[model samples]
Target: MTVTRDSITDFVRTLEDDISRVAICGTSYSDIGGVARVIEQQAIELRNGGYDIDIFTLEGTRKPPEDVSLHALGHFETSPYKEVDKLLTLASPSALNFVRSANRFDLIITHRFPFSTLGHMAKVIHNVPYVYWSHPSGSSDELFEGLAHAWARVQHHLETQNYAVRKADYLCAVSEESGEYIEAKTGREAVVVPNTITESRFGDVADEKKINEQFGLTPHDTIVLHVGRISPRKNIHRLIEAFQAATEGEAECKLLLVGEESMPEYSDRVRELADDDVVLTGFVDDKTLAGIYNRSNVYATCSLSEGWGLPLSEASYFDLEIVAFESIPAVNSLDGAYPVVNEDYDEFREKLCEKVNRD
Candidate 1:
């Protein structure tokens, strides 16, 4: 049966009644990237609502509340070959061990690619029904040039991902585009449950003095914030370039990047372009992140694509204007979101400057 939001709700309630425990398994989960953040938030929401969820991750610390449980198995490097890590993580024995220790769970919810393979394996081994949370398709590689060698590797991974999708008992996509991609690739319908922002979790900016001091900013400085992984896919280099052109030699403007680097090479390249005014915070907790959002003048991203623009939505909640690519379907649905022509840094720079001026 085709899954809709209402149906998924009903299905989840049914699972809640029938099963005593549910496991949320993923490749890597922390408060950093959107996928992990979404999964983390879902687990919290579910638990707060009286559902039992135990999060299992391949790598990352378990910092959830006392009532909640988190199990992490240290990360492993696949081999001498790169990009194969995604596949190796899928085959992680930790996932299988978690499932076997429980002997059985009422349901399994797996997020993103490769990790969803764990859900597929659970079904084969124990006949447990599993839900797969779909993310950007591996075929996204086709959009970027000079990835021919990586394309073959990506295609192999995509095929494995598609196989898992076909085997999943239920599917969820974070955005309509992702849902459509899953359907196109696996011929299975998926429910759309976009990432959420908890209003109560935010408050007045945590003392601006402390924040500014932390980032070496002055009261007159205009913070242009970008939060997420630093990688080629994030198009952070473009954002930095746009910021430089927009602000030029203005000492009163600063750019803050608050997340870990997924691609070290890309991180180095972005740093090469950044001036002393750019502050890369690496990673910050949700409380600090909320303060950063509240303290910033505007939010900006030039991601080539997104399953859902969770950060943009979070920024909008704080009444910050958004600057992003027009092709980003996720941000289009958010209020205060300004989309420019795709990859048009000149226009992106103009928009950034406009938001700064208006603020």
Candidate 2:
């Protein structure tokens, strides 16, 4: 994600005009996620643009920063409480009703999930101009011919996701590469607006030492951090394997998982992985997590796919050298994120060992 300053300047230009009312819809709004954080960043900017942003959340009441003026309207999952939320997503009927209630908005900006399907309905039914926000791709069609995947669910997801993108009045991608991928997939050129940074995590340097102490880590320990859903798409298991492999001889390395687990089986699997070196502190506060980022010896993810890796960007903000698989949407941004080809255990080991030895 090599960006010319002009592109950022131009993207900021679109916000000059005052926006009145906007329905910012997404499931992850209340949770700790890269995409959710990206959406939260936009909600703040839109609020500054004079738009009163009304959020349709799937769950939780975690408010956005004060300057952003965002409010959650709903929640979806129950267990980890923060488990996957589906606010206003087509998968839920409450979302359908929100679209009806949100008809007064001048525009709608959707991120990830249900927004794609609901945005179209918001337009066709209420005459609202829906803006489709693209984040990251969770697929690699390199193995498949024209279709993204031969698996029925993967194929269905693409077909459905394509319909949602093509139906939007305007599309804003989190990254230019994602925009190009969307254009090639849907025959519609989307506008690229990569995820912006909040001053605390990006503009200002974090106190890693302060944050690490709060996480119960000694100054000498090397804490490897991962922040994303504990779901399958994040490729957490692979990260565990890599970490286990990377730290066999290094006695000082530790791994900390910051987000809430997403599924029963997934949680069980991860819990099963608990041992001397791994710490699972499910869903810490943003301030605390930022502190942990500051204290990290290295930050990494083996995310198999993404719309864009928000954590990766945040990791870069802290200047922590990262290690990740290069295929993820955010791979392009990780100049410091040492990438290994996905599942290339050998190559992953090589990179991990190099980073550890260099550290």
Model 1 misplaced stretches (Cα beyond 4 Å): 1-11, 14-17, 78-83, 89-93, 101-103, 137-156, 159-161, 198-205
**On residues 198-311, what C-alpha lDDT tens digit does candidate 2 reach at each position?**
654343444766665556677788788888778766767778888888888788888998888856777788778766788877887767767777777788787776676778
Q: Using Cα atoms with residue i matched to residue i, what is each candidate's TM-score against the true structure?
A: 0.87, 0.80
Give the winner by TM-score: 1
Give the distance in Å from residue 269's predicted Cα in candidate 2 to where it truly belongs: 2.0
Cα-based lDDT for every prediction:
0.75, 0.68
Compute the lDDT for candidate 2.
Answer: 0.68
User: What is the TM-score (0 to 1) of candidate 1?
Assistant: 0.87
Q: Which ranges of candidate 2 are over 4 A from the true structure?
A: 1-19, 67-97, 101-103, 139-162, 201-216
The alpha-carbon root-mean-square deviation between model 1 and the true structure, to one decimal in Å, is 3.2
Q: After superposition, how far is residue 299 of candidate 1 from its true place, in Å?
A: 0.2
- Model 1 per-residue lDDT tens digits across residues 1-359: 44456333444775546765778877677666677767777777777666678887776664764477888865557554444566666446775576566445778888765557767777888888888887674345543445434755574456435678787998788767777777777777777777676554565447678888888888998999998888767888888988888887677888999888866667898899999889998887666888899889999998867777788888988888899987776667888898898878888999998887766
